[model samples]
Target: MEFILDTVDLEEIKDGIDHMPISGVTSNPSIVKKTSPEDFFGHMRKIREIIGKDRSLHIQVISLEADTIVEEAHRILKEIDDQVYIKVPVSYEGLKAIKMLKAEGIHVTATAVYDLMQAYFALAAGADYIAPYVNRIGNLGSDPMELIGNLQDRIDDDGYDCKIVAASFKGVEQIKNAFNYGAEAVTAPYAVLKQVFANPNIDKAVTDFNQDWYSVYGEGKGICDL
Candidate 1:
């Protein structure tokens, strides 16, 4: 029901987190590259202070080994707020880590998904969330929309808790399509979310409505003399 800004630049993320209706933040290696080379925990500690403990903050692990990944997940969660969600990939190692983490009562986000099958696999593996790279899949000559559609249908028809998190949104249209496909949540860059509400037509319509209201009555006076 809320949009999560997928960015690593703390300033940019903070800007959106402060003004926009962004429910959370998701970041991967690529996103991290855009941030500082400082310690990852340092970054998360600052983020926790900015977002508070009540909000969800997703942080990905660097380890590919299941044991290492699980350990890293625990360490990361301990450093950040209690709402920090771990991001696990859809692989054999990731599955193992997810199972271990979930058993430990740590929330896990199954990321790097491609199709409905992967989403199903994530659910079968018992992940708390499923992140499908909509635009990245589109770039691969695949219909991410259809993939998400089938995923939603299958999940709702069977009643699964693995939520669909639409990731890698390229534009505003992609955001709309992800919503239409009934993605539980969509993670996009701050720029994309900013463009989502930007439209010349909406601007013109608002101006026209204001002018019409001012004509009969007065500026900022939609109510008549009473």
Candidate 2:
């Protein structure tokens, strides 16, 4: 399973890659607005440097038309690298764009997916990754896990090469459930992922273990010191 970071913050990206099993980095316009980098392409290049070409970097296109979306995807590849995944929303125009981009052998990630039909359409259009809005689906009184489960079944039964990269998580449980429902990947904020180790009992257990070790080896001493 892939644990992708969903932020544009350089420090968060660095810390996450350093401390966790981060597989890739994903960003949308809103996420970019948070950082508001002076040079957009330069900032993305820095991110590519941090993660390296081995990891995926997903960048969304702002164009609403299929022609412009294709143009933007080409420009993003030119500005960044060809390895960058072009994130296009799963709309009528977006589906068209996905087909066009895929025809050129460009990586395409279908974002803003909220329904099974949208995902099916994207899958048929050759999207490398289909992003379903987990929390947003739940907030709309629909079961997000159901959507994920059905999508996974389709991908398995149909033998599609696509992956479900679930997004829009509000908490750790949402991310957990996304994986449990058969999502191959889930992108969440660094803060939400960090909460996995935020339990007070975890800290308490570590403190108790250290205290027992100190009682025998003296405080502030390591095994190497012996």
Candidate 3:
């Protein structure tokens, strides 16, 4: 499974990549507003430099119309490298944009997917990835895992070359459940992902191990010192 950070914070990106097995970075207009970069394209370029070309960088389009969305996709490709995945929400017009971009061989990620029908439409339109809002769906009184499971079944049964990249998580269990339900990847906040290591017992175990090591080798001495 792939773990993607759904934020545009520069330091968080660097630290998350350094510490965790980060596969990519994802950003929406809201996420961008959090960082409020002075130069948008330039900041995205900086992110590309940090993550390198091998990893995926998903950037969303602000336009709502098909023509403008397609235009925005091209501009994003021109501004950032061509390898960037253009994130289009799964709307009526967004599907049209996805079809056009796919025809031109541009990578497209369908976002803001809520209904199973919407995801199916995006898959039919040739979206490379379909992001279902996990927590949001749950908050709406629906089982997000059921949606993910059904979507995965459709993908496997139809032999679609699309992946389910579940998004909008609030806690770590939700993330785990997403993967358990057949999500190939998930994009979550760095702080939420870091909570996987937040249990006090984990810290206590490490501290005890260090104390025992120090008792034998003395304080301030590491294995390298020997």
Candidate 4:
């Protein structure tokens, strides 16, 4: 499974990307707001600069109207190139907007999906990616793994170019669940990604290494292992 960093702080993400073992970055309005309550567009500009023109970046559009979303998609993409992915919801307006964007060859991620049928419908609408939130499904006491399995097989059997992006991951177990089912990508928080390196054995190894490393080299790699 490919890893995507779920963060809006471009500096933090860029600083860590070289060693983070991630392929890309994901940011919604919520994550953007957390980064700066009053200047999302400005933050996005900084992000584009940090990532450069050819690197991939996922940015969610806030418009609920098809026309507005379409317009926003073009504007965001114009910031760089095709590497930019516009995230739209799975509403009727979003479907229309995504189809239009796709027709123009813009990468679209259909978000806010909660069911297997919704994911299928998004692919039918020609979305390049479909994001199904695992934490949301699990909060309703439903079997998210079952949905992941079903969608994985359905997409593979149909040979759709559209991919499944497991979103809103809660922990390493959830990440592993999606990976085991062959999710094309996973967008999880810094905390969740950082947590993946933290098992009892891993922690013991780290503790032992830290103690032995200073004697051998006087410093560690300064990487955030946990």
Candidate 5:
């Protein structure tokens, strides 16, 4: 039931962490390209300051080879903080890197997972978190929820410590579905997550309650005022 943000925007991260019970912030190369910060490591450090040490910060590697990926991860850990989780795509080389990182007691989040087999591989490789691309999977004509559910079942049955961190959401419903299907976490855009409170019915209910209280109290008189 962890709600994570999928962005590198500092202001949005601050606002989201301030108002929401966000577990962490996750960013891939594509998301980082949006911000294009002049000081990459500095910007990441600032993010850590905002979220504090309690929350997790996931940073993806830019290399394609197994050794290079491991090297990039080490550099990121050295530059940022070692507590940062390295997000490696679930590929042939990425899986190799995950095993190596996990052997070193480094946190590894296996990303770009679109199928159950990929998730299984990542889980077996000791990934702390397995990220499944929900929207993209659906676009590929597969039920992403089913995949998440299956993965959850496997984790529960085998006593695996790995968690499913669902990603690539285009709508809030998809995010909800991920949770409903047993995803331990779901990372989505700021706007998509904020839209949960966008329903007019919620606002209307709050406004009506306030109006009734004002009518009885004769205005400007709250429970505290009384």
Candidate 6:
């Protein structure tokens, strides 16, 4: 399973890479608004510098029309690196954009998917990743796990190269649930992913183990010292 960061903040990206097995970085217009970078392309280039070319970088297009979306994708590729994954919403127009980009061999990620059919459309359009809004779907009274499970089944049955990169998480449990439900990757805020280590019991257990070790070894004399 891959852990992807869903924010554009450089500091958070660094932290996520250092602390977690971050596979990629994803950003939407809303996420960009939060950072409010002065130089859009320059900032993206800086991100590429930090993450390097090994990990993926996904950027969403603001255009709603198919032609403009495709145009924006090319512009983004020129502005950023060509390896960047163009994130297109799974709308009627966005699907058209995805098809066109895929035809040109551009990496595409299908976003803003709420329905199973929308994901299927993206898969059929040959998107590399399909992001389902997990918390949003749950807030809408739908079972996100079931949706992810069904999508996984479809992918396995069809042998599609597409991966389910679940998105829009609210808490740590939702992240775990997404993976448990067969998401190949889950993109979440750095803070949300870091919350996996937030439990007091984990800290207490570590403290207890260290205290016992020190009590016998007489302080600072760990196994490495021996």
Q: Residue-wise lDDT of candidate 5 within 87-127, one digit each (tens)? A: 99999999999999999999999999999999999999999
Error of 5 at 193 (Å): 0.6
* List of clashing residue pairs for candidate 2: none
- Local distance difference test, each candidate: 0.84, 0.97, 0.96, 0.82, 0.95, 0.95
After TM-score superposition, the amount by which residue 112's alpha carbon in candidate 6 deviates from its true location, in angstroms, is 0.3
Q: Given candidate 6, what's the lDDT at residue 1?
A: 92
Per-residue CA lDDT of model 6 for 1-226, tens digit only, reads 9999999999999988998889999999999999999999999999999899999999999998999999999999999989999999999999999999999999999999999999999999999999999999999999989989999999999999999999999899999999999999999998898888999999999999999999998898989897
Q: Which RMSD values do the candidates have, in order? A: 2.7, 0.6, 0.9, 4.4, 0.9, 1.0
Each model's TM-score?
0.88, 0.99, 0.98, 0.86, 0.98, 0.97
Off by over 4 Å in 3: none
Sorted by lDDT (best first), the order is 2, 3, 5, 6, 1, 4
Clashing pairs in 6: none
lDDT comparing candidate 1 with the true structure: 0.84
Off by over 4 Å in 5: none
Specify the highest-lDDT model's number. Answer: 2
> On a 0 to 100 scale, what is the lDDT of residue 71 in model 1?
86
Cα lDDT tens digits for candidate 2, 1-226:
9999999999999999999999999999999999999999999999999999989999999999999999999999999999999999999999999999999999999999989999999999999999999999999989999999999999999999999999999999999999999999999999999999999999999999999999999999989998
Error of 3 at 85 (Å): 0.4
Candidate 3 vs 5: which has more lDDT:
3
* Deviation of model 2 at 146, angstroms: 0.4
Runs in model 6 with CA error above 4 Å?
224-226
Q: Candidate 6, 82: how far from true, in Å? A: 1.2
